[model samples]
Target: MTAVEEKLQLPRIYKQTVKMALYDLCIVGAGMMGSAAARHASEKSGVKVCLIGPQEPKIREIVSGNEVFGTHYDEGRIMRATATSPLWADLAKRSEERYRELENLSGVQFYHEIGALTVGTRYGQFIGRTKSSLKGGPKGYDNVEILAAKELNDKFPYLTFADNDEGIMEKSRAGYINPRKMVMAQIVVAVNQGCDVIRDIVLNIEKLQGVYKLTTERGKIIWTKKVLLATNAFTGMHQLLKNPVSYKAMPQTVTLAAVSENTAKRLSQMPVVLYEGKGGESWSKTYPRDSSDNIQFYLLPPIKYPDGKYYIKIGHSDDILKGSLELTDIRKWYSGKGDEELEEELFKLLDTIFHGVRFENHHGDACATMVTPGKQPYIDLLSPTLAVALGGNGYAAKSSDEIGRIAADLILTSKWTYDIPKENFKVKFHVPSKL
Candidate 1:
């Protein structure tokens, strides 16, 4: 034992091991946008990046502990970038490519090809408008196919359609992506690529002499040469951005219910389905169940919201978010109370699809923020070292990498040029009644 122990001593150091200093860039809020931005910023600019967010913090901690619930957290259902703009199509395709590449990069499964179907009445004006307005090929929307009701029903026999109904059936070019897993994958990639992902909540930002200093809730001050504020829904992140209006920050509540696969089967065959029908609200979307076999609840996108009466959220224009609402402060939407009447509306929708499912499996609710200040997202510069790229609302997932690309380019080149054609920020709802 003595001889073996003596031979197993620590190796002598040949040279001093140097510790690197603080990063060149710091990304606040490690949700989808932040994580994705951090990865690209580091890779493109070759600058060390520091990612700050709560990762499974103790339950009482103020940051992510109350929000991000470890691997149990998720970003609901995702759609392939199907916008009628070439800029949107290119951005979406890039996001989709990265999602697929993450599997090999992180050895974690991050995408599912459940696919999507947009349904509406054949003779309905909404359907006709969708086909026509989406025509003449917006930059990124040239490859999409438009289908009539019979063809849609034939391919997806699981769904019922009226005779005069029409459909758009897309293939691998579009499908379902697991938002949470994709986020985790980006986090892992950033870590492996030599980015520092710190576990802390940023309290404030102070600029001294052109360098950015970030103060954390724990009272630690970190300095970085450049800063990218990628907080998705955290209110604090919005205020930090040079331009608040560009964030157009708003909060929306959504529901996630667990119904047996048998029930999901009878509703819609595809993973993601949207209702743009004449008078129909986006009722339901079904993704193949997660590892837990629970389908996700995407609920409302940005255009979907309560009347915005006050601090807390209320009302929904559609059935999907309405019926399956889980009551909790996942995103801190409250005045210290649960809106039972709102819960009842959500229950009505859940009851329609999942007739007898028990609420025992109803995981507590969660929330995230949307930033679509304008029709086209602006990646502009208010200062030399500071840049802002936000306002996608819930649609950020489709264009996040490009968002990061533009943000990073602006910071590195001191130029505010858009990598993707910016959608015009109309200050109007992006969708009718919201998806």
Candidate 2:
């Protein structure tokens, strides 16, 4: 054959076989933690990183009917330094410290530093733990103050609390973050640092000759030296590790009450509030009638949604939505019509809190978080070449920057350099079926 004809044949030969792309590290589930890990690993370790995950479903005026849902697929998430545990408190502080830096680097506005309040009876277990956390957890918590009921009322006039209830205010470096924007910011940084982000779902992961091969839903193969699974609730649905990690995929429901623009403007200065019943009771009970029980509910300040209306978001604690969910269950819950009972309850609660304001609209959505038995995240070496970072225990979004750093640290050096106690986040495969 002629030389030109032979070259044409060579091109055809190369096209006959597919080449699998190799990466230094492959991260599955590019949610909050995975996205941050991709940014940190690529920038710090200077290795080729590939982040694989499905894009967040678009936010619609109606919460239901979404194709996919994630905990971080919302407009705002509370970012507070106060926590029931010192470990989480420190992690929140660490994550907050990097927020401004991330925003500047990515040119995305993600954090709102208004403030945060934890309200409950002074003797409540959560309040006591939060007080202790402020006392000993992090240095930036010096501005935290315990406010009496009267003081709370005087300061936050729009909020109504029980006569004996008090509030712990993280006066500075506490607020809400645009979670969707934050993930985009992290991905932007990662991409700028030469990390490749693949918009594909990971079907399975297999180990061959000390290297991990990830099989995607699109039938593509990826070979990597290490793999990090930050799949959160979806972790239970996938067998990514040689030894499976035990976790409960607890689904959480959050409701948002859209108020008039004037109302939102009036409540603009309000801080994120963790509103509890008199003695830390669930807010599910009719308020004012049964005010002497335990309740747990968190409130975010008015933030504009895509529907051109400002909404005040409130989410119930996982204790209320208690159950492990399968992948199909989560997808169905996300895409199905929202719960009318929950929406009504949210309206009643909002009416009780914001008395005179009229709610222009009301909506609700479902998201799931993986909770380990210890109520902390599991970041450990699953196998020789695979490390898993899952189970945010519902607090992963606010502390994700630090968790990501820890995950990347574990994968790169087999150890973490953070001051967080190893026992707090170390992997413990022995988990009970009931959380």
Using all chains and alpha carbons, the TM-scores for the candidates as numbered come to 0.69, 0.88
What's the CA error at residue 214 for candidate 1, in Å?
1.0
Return the lDDT, model 2, position 202.
86
lDDT of 2 at 345: 75
* Global lDDT of model 1: 0.51
Q: Write the per-residue lDDT of candidate 1 for residues 307-413, one digit (tens) a residue.
A: 22111111232222322222234334422123444454444444443323343222133333444533455455555666555555555665666566666676667
Q: What TM-score number comes out for model 2?
A: 0.88
> Candidate 1's error at 206, in angstroms?
1.1
Q: Against the true structure, candidate 2 has what lDDT?
A: 0.76
Give the Cα error of residue 296 in candidate 1, in Å. Answer: 17
